[model samples]
Target: MVQTTATRLKNRLRRTDGQLQGILKMVDEGRDCQDILTQLAAVRSSVERIMGVVVAENVKRCITDDQLDTDQQAQLEAALELVVKNH
Candidate 1:
């Protein structure tokens, strides 16, 4: 993955991790259901965004890899299959 994209994704994941911890604390403290669900949805959206960045970077790599041979193509295909199968 490109450095900038990777950094961005990592930062997003860190935020999501914090959000998850907050959710846990909320559950432990018996917070309102609506607020908890809202935070949960935000975390889910952040995760989805991270997935999108990863897939986009992989697609870019596939398109721009000049040394891609038959073996590499097959590997790319398998990787793409795994990505597509998620969610």
Candidate 2:
């Protein structure tokens, strides 16, 4: 079965949540600092990728939407730019 974008993103989020839980367990078990940092980095990368996908999808939708007036389109583009820049 084909997965929708939302489904794929949700799965990614679930995996990220699992990674966070693992990190917490690692902390409780006194795992090495470097190992924890590596896991943290992986989580960060995953989240960034999710964010990119979401932003790209939104931009694609906005660009293709025929009902949006010029002002609305500009606003959406600006908002997307802010999200990308802040991330």
Give each model's clash number. Answer: 0, 0
Q: Which ranges of candidate 1 are over 4 A from the true structure?
A: 1-3, 65-87
Give the poorly placed runs of model 2, Cα more than 4 Å off: 65-87
Local lDDT at 10 for model 2? 98
lDDT by residue (7-70, candidate 2, tens digit) is: 9999999999999999999999999999999999999988987897798677767576687888
TM-score of each: 0.67, 0.73
Model 1 residue 41 CA deviation in Å:
0.5
Q: lDDT by residue for model 1 over 21-87, one digit each (tens)?
A: 9999999999999999999998887787678668867796768567688888779777776664452
Worst 10 residues of 1 by lDDT: 78-87
**lDDT score, candidate 1, position 5:** 72
